[model samples]
Target chain A: MTLTPKGEARREALLDAVLRVLERDGASGVTHRSVAAEAGVPVASATYYFATLDDLFVSALRRATQQQVALFADLGEHDLRGFAEVMHDWAFTHRGAAIAQYELMFLAMRRDALRADAEAWYGALEHAIDPERLHPVRTRVTAHAIDGLLLRMLWLGEPSTVGEIEAAVREITSAISA
Target chain B: MTLTPKGEARREALLDAVLRVLERDGASGVTHRSVAAEAGVPVASATYYFATLDDLFVSALRRATQQQVALFADLGEHDLRGFAEVMHDWAFTHRGAAIAQYELMFLAMRRDALRADAEAWYGALEHAIDPERLHPVRTRVTAHAIDGLLLRMLWLGEPSTVGEIEAAVREITSAISA
Candidate 1:
């Protein structure tokens, strides 16, 4: 549904609040009441924006994924350091959001509706790596490796520093290029 | 805890039931009573085996990981086809348990207790790739890519067939070797 500018801002606030509630209490704790309370808005406001708990949860996930896609798209084509910093920020600095994003994929496995959102993440990574789409096969294979690296960073918390992450990125690109 | 052979079998059954519940109902659906009912065991048996929901959940995760590690270890070093088949089965045929394994990583992000279980998955992959522990950095970089590929399979359902998965595995290995 179309929303006014003020209405849009309120919707975004509610979405952001969903992530906070997810981070703080896990998925089970989320409800219209909890999200409204988290957003400091009326319960009616949350219910008006999100008809159900799944709507609230799914919208927040979409927002997180979109933010990540934007981050990847904004990177310079050959900016290993910039990529590393973004990776660090996503995995460590803004960790809850990253987890929420991955949680979307897990949910997508069950809900066919979210499959496109899940694929969008991989598409963003592939575009960031090869903007011209020069070599589809090579780019995809490389994207898979990088995807695995991101999961590693999130799960194991290794390549903990930006410097280390940069080094890992270098290894991936150089290995693929060679 | 030590168990008689029959007792051990019952405990394993309950753990398996947890995955079924998680697969069917998501994490929120899990409770000692639910798992016990799933296992067709008395509620007291589940409580006796696992004192709390967290205990039941974590132990099921640990069991799933152990099974996966054993699968990896059993493959012949050069058995790429076997690896592909195993991966396909894990990601598709036995999809729920695979999701449960990944869910463990999500939980690991918050609970320190599950970090080792999460790390153990990566370690298993690394060991499968480089059994002699040669080429530490190369093996790890390769592992990251392969890990990403597995996640892709789960989320996007790509490499949907064993042949495609085998081809993807070949691409990863040959690219790294080149």
Candidate 2:
């Protein structure tokens, strides 16, 4: 159903609150009541927009995916160093969003309904790597490699330095170019 | 604490039950009651052996890690083709174990106590790459790449063929060798 302007605004507010709750409390912290409180709305507002917690999670993940896509859209224009710098900066500044995304990915492993969102997120990574001038298979492998590295950094609570990021980016680019 | 042989056997049984529960029900499915039931032990036995659910989960993860390290110990003896073949077979036959491992990794992302297990798991992967004849940094990157690829395969419910695994492995070896 098409929402009115006010309805759309409220929906966005709720989605924003989902991220807030995720960042603050991790996945377990994201209850309807908590999200509603975070959004400064009645709990009914969350229930009114989202039929269940799964729906709310998917909405938030979709929003986060969109933001990531936007962030990576111009990656092709930049060199490997630039790409690495951007990613390194993002890892430091957006740890919460990154953690939430990984959590959602793990959640999707068990829930079939969330599979499409996970696939779309992977597809976005593929899209971002399209301009890297690599063979298709190489591009896919490299994308996953970068993904794994980033995941390790996040899980280990080790932020990637610019030098390390650049080295990884260079390795991928060189490997693919060859 | 030291225990009788029977006690050690029961503890192992409990840990095995944790993996079974994790595979069948996911992380949320794991509880003292559920694990005890799975193990065909009294609920009190579970609590007697493990003080809390977190303790049980960590013990299971540690056991899983030891098993993985054992599996990969001889990986350096094989060529990439052999390594890929073994991994592909494991992915198909031991899918539950793989899923549980990823689940535990995600859990470790939120809980600090599980981080060492995750690190040990990663370390095992790094050791397995010694046969690739690459620099230490290259080995580390390739390990993470293989991990990322395996995780994607598990998440997408698409088991990798030996051919696909070999190709990816060959790419990493060749990239680093060059």
Candidate 3:
């Protein structure tokens, strides 16, 4: 159902709170009451908005993915440095959102409802790598390496600086372009 | 701590129980009592075996990784089909252990104490890809792509069958070898 302007703001606030909770406590820590409290909305309002923990999580992940996809979409075709900066920002600067996205991936493994969102995340990576869809096989493999690199940055904290990350990106692209 | 044969058996049982509980309930569902119940051991035995939840999780993942590492180490150099079979079995047939290992990776993101186990996992993948450490850069990038492909298989359930998986593997390796 469509909501009033104020209701929309509250809904957005609740979704934001879900990411924060997910970042701080992982998936199991989120609940309607906790998220409502985190969002500064009434407990009733959270349930009214999301209705369940899964709703809060799935909605938040979708929103995060949209923002990230937009970031990738805006990049120039050969912007390795630009890509690295965005990766740094997402994996290090906005780390909570990155963790939230990956957590959603793990959650998606069990719940088929979240599969499309997970696929959308992977699709965005592929699109960013080859917006023109040229070299589909090469693009697919490069995207996979980039995806794994992103996870390594989060889990292992390697290529911690933008320069190093740019180098890592260059390596993958050059290897595929060979 | 040293243990009698029966105690060693009980400890292994508790670790096995942790994987089952992790697969069934995700990470947060694992507690001393819950794992003990899942393992058919008393709560005291669970706690005695693993004093805390982190201990339980880390130990189980380490064990699973060891088993997986051995499997990878046994692969012949040109055995892409064998690699595909192993991937299928790990992600599907013994699905719980796979999930349990991934869940530990998520946990390692938060806890530095678990970082070594997580690193060992990536190390195993790289070792599997190139046991002699030749073509370091190529191996690293290929491992990243392979890692990403594995995650996609688990999350999106694509390349579901062994033949499909082997074909996907071929695509990745051929793209890199080009």
Provide the RMSD of all predictions against the true structure, rounded to 1 decimal.
Answer: 2.0, 2.8, 1.8
Candidate 3 lDDT score at position A20: 89
Task: List, residue by residue over A65-174, the lDDT tens digit for candidate 1.
Answer: 88878999999987788989999999999887778667656755777778788888889999988999998877887898888888888887888999999999888878
- Residue pairs with backbone overlap in model 2: none
lDDT of 2 by residue, B1-178 (tens): 8999999999999999999998888777899999999999999999999999878878888888888877887675547887887678667677777777776776666677777877877787787777555567677667767877777777776546889778877876665446
- The 10-residue segment with the lowest total lDDT in model 2 chain B: B131-140
DockQ of each: 0.73, 0.50, 0.76
Each model's total of backbone clashes: 2, 0, 0
| Candidate 3 residue-wise lDDT, B48-139, digit = tens | 87887778877887887777788888888868899999999988887766876787777667777767776877898888788888899999
Question: Which of the two, 1 or 2, has more lDDT?
Answer: 1
Q: Relative to the true structure, how large is the alpha-carbon lDDT of every model?
A: 0.85, 0.78, 0.85
In Å, residue B3's CA in model 1 sits off its true spot by: 5.7
Q: Which CAPRI quality tier does the interface of model 1 achieve?
A: medium
Off by over 4 Å in 3: none
- Deviating ranges (above 4 Å) for candidate 2: A111-115, A132-134, A175-178, B111-113, B131-134
What DockQ score does model 1 reach against the true complex? 0.73
lDDT of 2 by residue, A25-119 (tens): 87778899999999999999999999899899788877887787777776765466777776776676777777777776666566677777767
True contacts kept of each: 0.73, 0.46, 0.73
